[model samples]
Target: MGSSARLRLYMNDNGPLILDGGLATELEAQGAKLQGDPLWSARLLHTNPQAIRDAHHRFLLSGADVITTATYQASITGFIDHLDVSCERARELLMSGVHLAKETAETFVCDARPAGQRCPLVAGSVGPYGAFLHNGSEYTGAYAQEMSIEEFKVWHRPQIDCLAAAGADLLAFETIPSIKEAEALIELLREFPNSQAWLSFSCKDGTCISDGSSFSEAVQMANRCTQLVAVGVNCCSPALVEPLLQSARSLLSPDMSWVVYPNSGEDWDSEQGWLTSEKTSASISELGHTWMKQGAALIGGCCRIGPAHIAELRRELKGSCTSPSSAV
Candidate 1:
């Protein structure tokens, strides 16, 4: 894996890319109560490391080509209030997530029951500042008076650098809601010489993110960075993602790749706070089929989409994409 050789694989790969989700809460379902941290994101890190492996393995079994590490909310800044986990310790947990995924994929390939099929790739997942800030607001002026981009660079450098060191095949900056924030990360990504990455936004009305930037604008900004392999929408309601995909296809270059992984639905209640309704998954899969026809390169489930939803997507994908020309 020399620099030039690795860079070539990142830039030239053509075909559908599969990304997996459901690590934090999914780990909870597997009997791990990650308590002790008020920061919701760090809890997953405190949980059994094996829980991280199992959730990713489920996605791999469901046919995902790329498995994302469970490090979305595993930030040192997010857990400073907690006395138990130090910044360094929290970061190691995040890096461990990446290591576990890559190691798991290697294990699967080596122990393949049917030897011929290949295993999935590992994708390092990065989340926002534990809040709902958009790209522009993420870093600009007085809001972060206590911290500068240099400080952020110091905090995130370890997490991102560790992922690079842990053998992540790609980096997935997901659920990004603003062009400003996306650009901030794009700038950091340029520092990584040969690593491939994807940027995904969470839209509101199909055209605008929660911060109010047009979806097309987000694509234009992301495209400015040459290292980006794909731009997409994730963590928004299923209804919003469809029109966003359609709008995105019209603006993006056909040679570029597209990915979509919408939430089950928008409604949330006490019992299932932020959970996607069961019916939404089936409908989202139906919409995913149409998106595949329009130019989406990859498809999968995000929040609330369990194995059953992935099963539906896989089944639909069988007939949804028939020719390479149809995939964008």
Candidate 2:
């Protein structure tokens, strides 16, 4: 089976997968100064890999069934410029993002998985083209108008290639802000026939994505992709989840699962990635059941969300998200 099918098996047997909260959130709390860094958390992949691993370990202990890599702001060019390395070396750094997450997940599963439970998944994150721009255009997608489809593909292919080649269980094409960019990504996804990915958008409201395209239209596009394991929104306000999912209900494919992980309520900064916000960490767990009821097969938090929130989320979902064990 392809990677997408691997995820389906887990969801089929284990119910909705519990995704991890923010990597940068944990990193910042650990005293890694991230403000004004163009590479964001990806910089740590080179300077302090153990920190990333430790963050993943905490989320795993908190009951995250899936952990995302710190590649959201990573790109070949960015790494080359920042690290002053050869192109090949830059690729290695990019691939290391997957390696670090995979290693951490493997360690967790070995120590924690009971007889019947499936192993937790490591999702290699592929952030939008705007993320590389370092201007927060990911929230607006204004850059899509400046690049051709081929240009967009050229920009994203390397990161996706590195992550897939590095052995992530699935790729997460997340925080996409425009329909055109989504179109490019969906087309690019077909090239890696054996690889599976989940596509998520950054919405401006309940009705449409950030670039003003209808959310329903984006959902239709996502479900048509043969390699997409799930589809929904991420990095937007938690309040938008219901309206976005409800609007897509009529057109959603039953075979296509929903994956929704929103930010903890804050404005996104281009340079900082996420503005410091006062989030009620408990609110994510408080609202998780409603998202599941709305047809989400996978749920978790985004920016500003941390291990405590994930523990609460797991607690709230304890009845359905039991400790993974084959004995069950």
* TM-scores of all predicted structures: 0.81, 0.92
What's the distance in Å from true for residue 295, model 2?
0.9
lDDT by residue (1-328, candidate 1, tens digit) is 6533553464354434545655655665666664333444345555566767777767666556667887766555554445367877766766787888888777765654322234566778887553323223321222344545555455556667777777687788887755556677787887886777788886767688756778888888777777777888887677776788777676786546777887667454534456445665446667876777767777776766765566556556642221122211
lDDT of 2 by residue, 38-97 (tens): 899999998999999999888887778899999999999999998888889889998998
Which regions of candidate 1 are displaced past 4 Å?
1-15, 34-42, 79-83, 113-116, 131-155, 269-272, 275-282, 319-328
lDDT of 1: 0.64
- Candidate 2 local lDDT, residue 92: 94
Best by TM-score: 2
- Among the numbered candidates, top lDDT falls to 2
Clashing pairs in 2: 115-326, 116-325, 116-326, 117-324, 117-325, 117-326
Worst 10 residues of 1 by lDDT: 319-328
Candidate 2 regions exceeding 4 Å error are 113-117, 268-282, 320-328
Assess the local accuracy of residue 210 in candidate 1 as a C-alpha lDDT between 0 and 100.
55
Q: What is the C-alpha lDDT of each candidate?
A: 0.64, 0.85
